[model samples]
Target: MPKMLCRCGKVVGLGEIPSSNQWMIISDTMITDEDWDDNGLNMSDFYKKMDIVVKCPECKRLYIYSKGFGNEPEVYNLEE
Candidate 1:
């Protein structure tokens, strides 16, 4: 597991390279190369499919999962 420290001095858990590649945390904003202009400057595509994903330092507060799109990890079951 890779350990990344947050600004608050907490060790963030990036346990496994996510079980599924289709899912990623939308941590920031980004535009892919294909969307760049002639000068290589990225053309705006905020509402498009391009995005920047990263591990949130605070998982408890910023975690999100898709119930139908990706396979959920098999950890301890959580009951409501």
Candidate 2:
């Protein structure tokens, strides 16, 4: 599998972002798993929202993940 990355074309996976709610996604709601992709997908459907996306550089990994916001968690954990 590919790794996480930065918009600057840099890989950031295998390590943490050092904090939550500080990272970006590369693509919208089309991740590695059907379920994980669906979490953001369902939310988008119900709330008419789009999942934030990010692309991994070296691995070309695309992410449709987000951090939570107050009252509502912006991101949800995926099931592997």
Candidate 3:
């Protein structure tokens, strides 16, 4: 499991599976007819091209993955 420190000083992931905080984001344009065809689809390959987002359970802050900026996630704090 991958773990990272949240800006709120809470530890995200914490070596455990995230039931709700983690999500996979796929662009609508990325999906093709091949993906819908069971015989042609490869989930592993599809997942690699997707982006990930994790919400800090403690502070409700969002950590969004940016493909252009290397591995570090871009942080977004919730607005009141």
Candidate 4:
């Protein structure tokens, strides 16, 4: 499971990733070839990416989460 820390230092559990229906697609025209080449990503690659909206229960702050369309490690550690 993944956890997120609020600015107030409150710990929040994000549980499992949401389903594909919850995903938001990025428009290809929003990204330029130069930007894609610099990042080694193309418009086609953007389809695999998504943004998840999360809210901190403690402070009510909203957060946008993404995995950069890659298999990466957790950004936050679990509390002992």
Give the candidate number with the greatest TM-score. 3
Best candidate, lDDT-wise?
3
lDDT of each: 0.38, 0.42, 0.76, 0.53
- On a 0 to 100 scale, what is the lDDT of residue 61 in model 4? 60
* TM-score-best of 2 and 3: 3
Global lDDT of model 1: 0.38
1-80 in candidate 1: lDDT tens per residue?
A: 24444444556655566522223433244444544554754334332343323234344222233332153332222244
- Each model's TM-score, in the order given? 0.27, 0.25, 0.73, 0.38
* Model 1: worst 10 consecutive residues (lDDT sum): 60-69
Winner of 2 and 3 under lDDT: 3
Clashing residue pairs in candidate 1 (N, C-alpha, C atoms within 3 angstroms): none
Query: How many residue pairs clash in all the candidates, one count each?
Result: 0, 10, 0, 0
Candidate 1's TM-score: 0.27
User: Whose TM-score is higher: candidate 1's or candidate 4's?
Assistant: 4
Pairs with steric clashes in candidate 3: none
| Number of residue pairs clashing in candidate 2, backbone atoms closer than 3 angstroms, sequence gap of 3 or more or interchain | 10
State the lDDT of candidate 3 residue by residue for 2-77, as single tens digits: 6777888988773556447777788899888777877857778987888877889998987778462258887789
Encode model 2's per-residue lDDT on 1-80: one tens digit a residue. Answer: 13443554575543444423234443455444774656555644533333344444444444554442213223233344
Candidate 4 has which clashing residue pairs, if any?
none
lDDT of 2: 0.42
